[model samples]
Target: MTTKSSLNAAPRRFALINDRIITAPKEVVPVSVLRALASIAADQVLVRDHGSPNDMVLDDRATVDLNDGNVFYTRARCDATPPAACGSPAKLAFAVDDTFELSTAAELPFEAFMALFGLEAGKQLFRDFESPNDQPVAPGSVLRFKDGPVFYTRGGQHHDARVEITIDGVKHKVAPGKTSGADLKKIGNVPLADELIQNIGGKLTPLADDATLCIAGGEEFVSHPRCGASS
Candidate 1:
């Protein structure tokens, strides 16, 4: 019989991917491959265990196998420089996956905090606003350290929240505010459907709002289905 003390005594396990180590549990479970890929956010190929291709599938479900060394290598772009070596003008500190981390900030024009992170303008910073969007906040306004890479994803709505849905028939989830044609394709590892399908109230509906994250799986309307073969 397993006791609470024994469970506590077990050391946590982690899998290393693209330099980031992600927590893994004793039980194998499904995780979003796209999300993990997005975390790297680089134009390059990834290989696992030296030779195995680290490719994401339509289902996008993956398990971090502890038996394997859980190693991944990136074939980064030739022209691209690692953020750490970019000689950023400032640094921002934040927490990702309960791990405190830092990132370099671009030495460019001062803008809103979210804008600093390449987000759409007018998105609030840490869900707060000191002034209107037109009023730009100077660089380093959001971080106390103000000397390394800017870690601002922790301030956005999509920090941990993702919208799950079934595209065609596979189950997958994309980060909030990223449900559009181009974004969904990248996240779901599949082609964009000529016709958008969404589940709503035990019925299927034409997916009109591709910008918001409130979407979920619903029933398709059998008669005059909005997202069916008739479309």
Candidate 2:
């Protein structure tokens, strides 16, 4: 009986990004060998075999990083097995020397700017007016009050009455006129929307002439992205 040689006895190199595989060198090489080499180099790798002009298969295979900070990804495809419908040809293009950067928590915006990432404050305050229910404000719930500058009360005493209230460490000021508690509640819950106005040193405009309300944060908000991408 005749014996068949291993298809991937020798490997080739290639580069990949943006879902497109770089063409291999002019010299013919075994596809399996190229995949094996790539798998060895990256923590995660993908291969696409374009054995035919029209057919492609994206083989999702990758290596995992245990202690290393790098992320690897790969895909593969083959052309000879089915209808000729693949998008491109398989070829070695170039070598990818990637430098991975670690993402730190410091990159996230402060609580005052949480609105940019769609996060809301856990606790908020309404100035001047009293809540209909005589209950301590709950976390993660909106608090409403009547419009006008809020009079800060300390030790059962009314302090300086100002439109601005410092929540946690973030400062939110009310508009000059009256606003309903409902309107203030909506503004506090929208971190991005409010922060945008606050950052510009602008006032939160009243929804209606009869509206009067304000909101303040309890603590600074912070966010961090678990990971990011780069070439």
Candidate closest to the true structure, highest TM-score: 1
TM-score quality measure for candidate 2: 0.17
Top candidate, metric lDDT? 1
Residue lDDT tens for model 1, 11-76? 333444555655545424343452364365445533343332323211224554333333444555
Displacement of the residue 116 alpha carbon in candidate 1, Å = 19
What C-alpha lDDT values do all the predictions have?
A: 0.36, 0.29
For each candidate, give its TM-score against the true structure: 0.26, 0.17
lDDT of 2 by residue, 137-167 (tens): 2223321111111111212123222345433
Off by over 4 Å in 1: 1-150, 153-160, 208-231
Error of 2 at 91 (Å): 8.8
Residue 90 in model 2: shift from native, Å?
6.8
